[model samples]
Target: MKPRSTLVRILAMATAAGALAWAVTAGNQPSHAATGPVADAGPGYAVEDYGYPNADKILAEKGILLKCGDGYIVLADCASEQNLLRFLARDRADVCFKVTGEKGYLALELESVHGVRTSDVSTTHLEMTAENDRVTYDIPAKTWEGVGESADGREHTLVEIRTTK
Candidate 1:
């Protein structure tokens, strides 16, 4: 009986010592989680300016200054498709845009614009600058309207276009 009791106490002490050693070793080891601010170099933060994408390249190649927009309206080829909003200018080739979504807006600069053709899906509102005064023209859906220099006798530069369904 005494020998059996002594063996039980020895086994219990060994287990307690093994557990304590394991706990101490684990407590001394460093963890992988971040405990403070790190000074390591990483990828830069992304910032969106929203001015216009590829604006400099487009202006240099095509002589068109597309400043900004909501990305719903985009420039398109005149002969690309039907139902496109088209613009006519005396000094340059015909400029056209494709309108999508429920509404669209674009700010640009086109010189000597004389006419505007609205698409069949939405009404068009155009703003132009003649001398120092601002001129606005509203064209209904699926219609051809005289604007800018053709409407008045002065040369006008198209500045903005807004459309709604």
Candidate 2:
């Protein structure tokens, strides 16, 4: 019902004011930690995000790469937990890791792993693969379960474990 000419003028004024305010704020120093955009962090600010910290140490000493995980389940030094997932390989006597959350994930290949222990509250899924064969498993709560050895006794490598809530 209002005049179109008057509406146009008001809108134009508002747009100009908003743009001017934006320009002014854009140049001003930020009042808080700039969660928006960083100027530049410079060289050596980069970090490896795919794997756990100090993964190299574990690989060199324990023969486990521990490339990456969802962080719910994680690698702990031996004897860190009352019970932990255990693997027996031809190359090593045992390899192990601890789980922390009700649901979690880990990606690794524990060669010739014959067994694993399960958490009390979470259901576990284990996957293994050989030259041309692949296998999957589900372990119930609080169980020390057999894996590659139990499943036809094949020397399969563990690829991934996905746990869910």
Candidate 3:
């Protein structure tokens, strides 16, 4: 076998170095809005339904149903970081949930996760109220972003939930 040319070796080394740098920089970036401390689901936190739908239509058509020890829990929609934050900030009735927009949008939702299900699938506007439970330092949306978590621990900053109503 002939030895590789000097130019080829140099280009290969440069490519490898660039890739390494990108990986390091990307890995160091923060993904989601600071969830503060994630409360453990605790014991008896059985999940009756926990699956991802392909599209908004599918999710809206076939929502995920979860049955905990307390009662049945239906997840109508779930989003990541900016979107979640936005949904919470605008739609959630409870004002205690607080989040700062930075680096990216905050994830949020107004879908029915608890209580009785609704027939209306139309998007509704959200309003901010006064309450205190989840709070964190305010950061501009351009300063931070969020990512979704997978079973394998992989993260995605964006996600869409679907279900059948």
Candidate 4:
């Protein structure tokens, strides 16, 4: 049999060789796995812009934008808006909101707002656009109004809603 010292030296040399092989191979991995999309230049990181700060993020994840509102007028659940203040869209389902205080405004552009229901107390105005025309309406307070294709048979989008005392 080989001497004890010779055997110990052989084992240590083997271990060192194995470690060197591993270290060399470890650095050769594809850089894509190491840095992900940061390796790209055109659009480094995807940015979802829904107009509001973090509201864009929320809308990106949930397909909804309800975080946009000052305090007086805000997005509300479709079931909770009394079905009185509701909207219908072409590409999307339904979007709703709750308006409070005497005066408020909402800068919303739900694509294809074919239907609407206005509140009772505050006089409201709707800014809308159809195929080739832009129209504005002085909505009667506490009344249901259809401003889009549902009303004029022209596909329209409710770009903005304004209310006042």
Candidate 5:
């Protein structure tokens, strides 16, 4: 009877040890199912494309096609603020932009832009294309300068505006 009891106790202990070893091995293995802090980590990372916000609305309403920008230079209401960078177009009304930071850049399409009035904050560079020819103008700060067709007799389209302090 003593030998039988001892054998039973040893069998129970061996079974318990096997179960614990199995549990530890299974726990150490990587799980396909998502759980715990890794699963609860919320959303993924965000990538910025630097596209102009509300560009479709502005294009539809104001006939100005704003493409991309560095976020420092933004479209603005001409009447909303003073010292805005203003543009003079052939058929369209004056378009304005607000400049911030040490440098700013904007790529857009405004047709027949003949002149530009740069703000007092920074010097502005205008890039335009006329009849397969690309032209660039460097305008001093706080000055109104002739650009595109205003400089040449041919019609020109404003393509980009870059500013630096």
Candidate 6:
């Protein structure tokens, strides 16, 4: 093989280095802003239908059993052992008394799913929020990964608490 000219080698090296740097920077950038007006970021997974007694019958009977946007709301099935209903109820009370007495929406995210059956998981990515004293949740995409009910009886993975303005 013949030795490449110095100019050619330097040019090739510079181009490779520049591409590498761009890739790293782009990968490190935040995919979405954490605290901003809720906007759909193309298509992705998120949590949805997050609230206390997240059922229609239960909500009507209990009369808003838990405050919106409070972390203490039992998002999962109440019959499940991993249910956080009691704990969330207590926390909701505390949060209600501490804040400006304004209603807020609670949001939850199932960050990742593991040791769970694929059949039990929802294919759609969900996003939930409470506004105007009503809980509104939506699925961002028709299909998503990393969401499923645990086979070992563990239901929820990641829970997030947020308030809507």
lDDT of 6 by residue, 19-135 (tens): 999999999887776545455535566765445444456445443334345442234443443212111221122111111212223443332222111111222222322222222
lDDT of 4 by residue, 56-110 (tens): 7657764654434445666767776463456767777677767777777666556
Top lDDT hit: 5
State residue 103's C-alpha deviation in candidate 4, in Å. 1.3
- In order of appearance, the predictions have TM-scores of 0.74, 0.66, 0.18, 0.57, 0.76, 0.19
Cα lDDT of model 2 overall? Answer: 0.75
Question: Between 3 and 4, whose lDDT is larger?
Answer: 4
Candidate that beats the other on lDDT, 5 or 6, i.e. the better one: 5
Model 1: lDDT of residue 7: 100
All models: lDDT? 0.89, 0.75, 0.31, 0.70, 0.90, 0.35
Ranking by lDDT: 5, 1, 2, 4, 6, 3
Clash count for candidate 6 is 3
Candidates, ranked, TM-score: 5, 1, 2, 4, 6, 3
For model 2, what is the alpha-carbon lDDT of residue 46?
72
As a whole number from 0 to 100, the lDDT of residue 149 in candidate 3 is 24
Q: What is the lDDT of residue 36 in candidate 3?
A: 45
lDDT of 3 at 58: 39
**Winning candidate number (TM-score):** 5
lDDT of 2 at 127: 83
TM-score of 1: 0.74
* Residue 123 alpha-carbon offset, candidate 5, angstroms: 0.3
Q: Give per-candidate clash totals.
A: 0, 0, 41, 2, 0, 3
> Where does candidate 2 clash, by residue pair?
none
- For candidate 6, the TM-score is 0.19
